[model samples]
Target: MPTSRFEVLGAGAFPMLVHGALILLLTGSIIGSLRKIPADAYGRFAADVVAWGKAKRLVFVVFAGLGLYVAVMPVIGYTSSTFLFLITLLVTLAPKTRTALVVALVLALVFSFGLNWLFAEVFNVFLPRGN
Candidate 1:
């Protein structure tokens, strides 16, 4: 028995309709852009990508930090994991002045501990608490 106005494989009609519309819209957008962007723009973009690939310092540093954060999140819990992540980012990216460091530290603490408390008590959405 058919459940929706448009159904062939038992999917809901509304979802199917939305998906079909999105496909058409995205296809039209891609086709339009394909004709609009110049060939030299693509060549310049590719050269920039290649240059970034060759200079892998910033990209690799971020990837390594993410890997470490994921690996230790279970051991340290959500609060510590988030705080450490923010601190690491600040240390690497933020200015080295004393005032900037102090402000970043304060913000990191508030984000980590404040968010944990808000989730657990206010929203009753408990986050992971590692041992």
Candidate 2:
């Protein structure tokens, strides 16, 4: 019945608006809570924040890798991408090998199957199976 691939102001906009509003609400809530915390907590909390900021290099790298994974996932397939993402995260974070491997395997399975299921079944969006 539809002619064009997309119709102006269709179903997609609602999700986008909802997500945006949720983000705004969450940001407000976090800011409000942080402000309400006692001033006595500031010394330790500020030190932790500074330490975290100083330790952000690896964090940035991981985020960059996530961007790369998203870019490549369409070509490599969800399972492969998920495995790479999980393994990369585990290795870079220097987790204990036994726990890292277990966590990586579990994460890969969850991401590949669970996310795929969510997209295909819950959202009715078909994510590409590059393989």
Candidate 3:
């Protein structure tokens, strides 16, 4: 007998269903895999994980780009920051060609500034206009 109103979870709430489902799933998995053979040896599972492999430079650049985007967003506004980020990603990932460049530029502009305009006009929402 609980006195609090929130103590009674009404209807099919998330915690009521999700938590039980997760518990059942984990318990079933644990029971089923009790005698199963392991794929990788326990100690060497992380041995090859440290190596960055061939795509190290690309991975690092993308990570840095994301960090820079977040850092510059407040200072340069969301539109400009997103434009730079999108342009960089599009240029780096797409094939090297004039058509690719034009498409990247157009997409970057459309997604960044165009979306900004849409939000401002249609949704009546204002974004940070830089510092």
Candidate 4:
């Protein structure tokens, strides 16, 4: 049976709709830009892409870690998952020094727990808690 319009727009529909629209806009922009690029520029674009891939490996790692964080949040609880994600990301990105490590740790703790506390205490919104 086909669902009604009301059912389609209920609950998580708004975010999904926004995401879809943003994706469409991004695709259109990319296609438009690529169409305007001259054939002679293809080699340069390819070289640029390769250089970016080599230099920005950490960017891919951070995105993968974020995906993992979202997947594990429901199982490990929001605070623990967020703390792990932030701390790991900070340590990965920060300089390899004792002071930097300490600063990253403090920032991770503050962001994870502070946000959690703010949401739960101030906003009266609760995140998922694992058993």
State the local distance difference test value for candidate 2.
Answer: 0.81
Q: lDDT winner among the candidates?
A: 4
Q: What is candidate 2's lDDT per residue for 1-131, written digit by digit as tens?
A: 23345666666677889999999999999999989999888779879888887788787888898999899889988767877787778667766688877877787778878888899999998877886
Best by TM-score: 4
Off-target runs (Cα >4 Å) in candidate 4 are 1-51
Candidate 1 residue-wise lDDT, 1-131, digit = tens: 36765655565667888999999999999999999989888769978888888798767778888899888888999899989998988778778999999988998999899999999999999888888
The runs of at least 3 residues in candidate 3 whose Cα sits more than 4 Å from the true structure, single-residue gaps closed, are 5-21, 47-75
Clashing pairs in 1: none
lDDT of 3 by residue, 2-117 (tens): 34566566555656699999999999999888657476556665655555444476887788899999999889998999999999998998899999999999999999999999
Candidate 4 lDDT score at position 112:
82
As for TM-score, the candidate ahead, 1 or 4, is: 4
Clashing pairs in 3: none
Better of 1 and 4 by lDDT: 4
Q: What is the TM-score of each candidate against the true structure?
A: 0.60, 0.48, 0.58, 0.62
What lDDT does candidate 2 reach at residue 63?
A: 85
| Candidate 1 all-Cα RMSD | 5.0
> How close to the true structure is residue 21 of candidate 1, measured as C-alpha lDDT?
100
Give the alpha-carbon lDDT of every model: 0.87, 0.81, 0.86, 0.90
List model 4 lDDT by residue over 21-127, tens digit each.
Answer: 99999999999998999998877987999999989999899999999999999999988999999999999999999999999999988888888999999999998
Candidate 2 regions with alpha-carbon error over 4 angstroms: 1-55
Model 2: weakest 10-residue lDDT segment is: 1-10
